[model samples]
Target: MNQNEAVQQNSKPRRVSKKKGKALNNPPVKRLLLPTVVYLIIATQIPFIVTIYYSFQEWNLMRPDKGVTFTWFTNFIKALSAPSFYEVAMNTLILTTSVLMICFVCGLLLALLMNRNFVGKGIVRTMFISPFFVMPTVSGIIWKTMVYNPSFGFSAYFANVFGVAPYDWFTQNPLLAVIFIISWMWIPFFMLILLAGLQSLPMELIEAAQLDGANRLQQFFNVTIPHLVRYIEVVVLLGLMFILQVFGEIYVTTSGGPGFASTNLSFLVYRTGFQSWDVGGASAIGVITVILTIVMMLLMFKVLRRMFKEEQA
Candidate 1:
């Protein structure tokens, strides 16, 4: 019996190893993935390579005579030194952070509310998620015209009803307006992710907490939040990536506005390349934006990891 058991254990490892080897050496899988890999390289990497090349050159479309000379870091220096660049960078940071916080909080609340059994829940969820389906440009236009138009829109109607002044959202508070619109649009996305997380949470854990004399808030903080950490990380990271590149709304609403107040890095890149015709500068900014994105994502991962470890401990 002992020898039979030993033989079975030895054969099991061999079988597992063989499976792993086959998976690793699978020609069919490699063949299937080859086209996708090549397409990704052609579609993404080639443009990035071209952008890097342009960043080292002094290319201004307006100055055709000067014609793309390799200036090597001049564009980087100018991009870093420009006063408007700092404002745009700050705006980008503020917008990304504000939207994330708002979305996270609102989404969590909504998720919690929706997680409970209720009538019309499906319709409510569908309505909540509907905004996410709207195009960014359409969202911007809707808010700009129907909601925020101080003269004849919803704001005006509300202000008149309350006998108060209609505030010019885009004009007086362009960055805040952009933040609000973005948060409104993204909250549903965050809610969807968090709802999935909430639903997947083990009911036994909640029951255990309750039996241990834990109150609702205590259970929520000690149990629910910890369980949702991964979902939160996913929501935050994805939101950060998309929010950092938000341009359509900004373009439609403020157009980077009364002097770069609403200009993010993405909008700045467009403004530099298309409007200002500074191709080199735009390329440099684009590279910098990519670096910033990677660093921020790394830092977020580190912070979340530490939090998760502490929770486990």
Candidate 2:
């Protein structure tokens, strides 16, 4: 054989190298996600665990020397047996349920109205959404001092017009007053969510309903609302979480009274932890609040899942 032919025959087979994946899947990717995981654990998870632990103990800032030794549900039992606890629970549920209803109905109305072609659509939408931006503390004080104060508020002005007594807001009706303030603050959020949901819905369905002899009310009930059911449910769930945990409003307006009238569970926790200085009971309430929020979120997720499944099937 020629030398050139021998060299060609001795040539090694070509080996192909596999492509490396585009993204790293190990510590680098995890390094990016790790901060968030760490934050969640530190900011939320660990504190929650500590709260649960403290719930079963008896500790007050007044007596730090006294370690938070476990008392095994004594605080929980005491909370239950407190007469005001029952009243406050009822008031809390009422505030949660009523304000949610008001927000839903009024918000849906405002959202539907804004969905129509209006000259000042942008302004109206902004106005509707503005209240949600107000922090709870600011909103609470604003309502208490500016809007509901019998001496200087709109109520007082109107009372003068009619030559009637200037009725006190928080003093006379604490539950209703707090509910109105909270509802006012939260309605904007509801409106924005529902309005977005309504806008995203297919117009063809609405037109089809109209063509099928459905009047305005009929179309709204049969078409628009059915499309918004999940959105509304989610909104209500979120609102319930907020309302159940309302404290700033109670603090600013009623201070949990005229007599525990506006004292929701959150305020009860605050009162116990700070005013009465019972950290253990406060921790128990915190644990309960977390559980309530979790349970509500779970229920809402189930509802959304069922809705999704029905849509898919």
Candidate 3:
């Protein structure tokens, strides 16, 4: 019996030998990781860093005669001097905040509805989520051609039925038009994330709240909303990031204008860099965008930390 016990002990799995353990972190794996890391640095990190560096210069990206001379914030000064910059910045911020607010609120309601059991739920979920799966470019094109076309759009058809004008959208209130397009495209994403968060919440807590005389609103406010705060932060931040990056919608729907009316910072960057090939000014704008994003992220993180700390307490 002792020998059998000893044999059983010996039969238990052993840790890998030092050589094998080291081999597990093999050179081949390191080699593969190196290329990916390098690619990321080259494709994203390095270019971003270079853009920041060039934001202080006056190079036109084409004028070899001007070359790589630093002008010590003069590029940024020029960017700030552009009359359209401030308006575009404000428009971008307004669009981003408005889109996030509407999408998140509507998403929460839709997600709550989706969480409940119902017939044809799967198909319904797919339908609701389909917008998020569609490419941004495609979404913009469809909205531009099918939904906002004053002459033949769905809106025009409805307006004609009601004896009202089709009401040209992009030509008039272009900012509102862009916001609607961006919000429509992003609402599905918000719904998916919020729904997952809602479904993953602890059921016992909810039931306990109910047992303690909490009404639906009370339970949601006291328990559910507090619990979902983290997920809510993530959704808001993600929405802001994506919305700030909105260019295709602008490109397709309004081309950043009947004038500069619909131009956001991203579109501004595109116009400066590509359309006019003012690389220095574009880099400056890019740097400003990066700074704004970082500021927003830091602010959100500070708020998030406070909430989580309170949650832990």
| Models sorted by lDDT, best on top | 1, 3, 2
- Report RMSD (Å) for each prediction in the order shown: 5.4, 10.7, 6.5
User: Which of 2 and 3 is the better model by lDDT?
Assistant: 3
Per-residue lDDT, model 2, residue 274, is 93
| Residue 233, candidate 1: C-alpha displacement in angstroms | 1.4
- What tens-digit string does per-residue lDDT give for candidate 3 at 1-313? 3566566557544433556765553436677799999999999999999998878778776787878777889988988998889998998889989999889988999999999998999999999989887887888889888988999989899999999988898888999988888888888899999998898899999999999999999999999898888789878877877887898878887889866799998899999999888888899999998898888889788867776665544
TM-score on alpha carbons, each prediction: 0.88, 0.85, 0.85
Locate the minimum summed-lDDT window of 10 residues in model 3: 9-18
Q: What is the lDDT for 279 in model 3? A: 81
lDDT of 1: 0.91
* Counted clashes in each candidate structure: 0, 0, 0
Q: After superposition, how far is residue 296 of candidate 2 from its true place, in Å?
A: 3.2
Clashing pairs in 1: none
